[model samples]
Target: MTHAFYVYASYGFAALVTIVVTVWTWADGRARRRELAALEAAGIRRRSARPKDSLGDGE
Candidate 1:
């Protein structure tokens, strides 16, 4: 009822998954920041466009 191979396999799989996730997260964060900076430099704010008030009563 021993499980030496199972323990080793589980550890190896965990390590592989951790490495992949870390690399993917780092790349995505860097790319996102770079894109935001470029947009700001071009005077383009994506979230600044909001709708105006709709109570048409002649202000």
Candidate 2:
């Protein structure tokens, strides 16, 4: 019912959102890395990972 209560509640909600997003991003990155590793193990590679000379761009 007071201004201070509203402010504190808003700040708490923002903090909670920030922490959730941070954890979600971290977990997604780990999952993507694992997927990339699996793909590499299956003989798939990112084009950028190839040697520049192998691209045959007349280096």
Tens digit per residue, CA lDDT, model 1, 1-59: 45988999999999999999999999999999999999889988764453466335464
- For all predicted structures, in order, the TM-scores are 0.67, 0.88
Go through the candidates in order and give each one's C-alpha lDDT. 0.85, 0.96
Collision pairs in model 2: none
Maximum-lDDT candidate: 2
At residue 13, give the lDDT of candidate 2: 100
lDDT per residue, candidate 2, 1-59, as tens digits? Answer: 99999999999999999999999999999999999999999999998899867988764
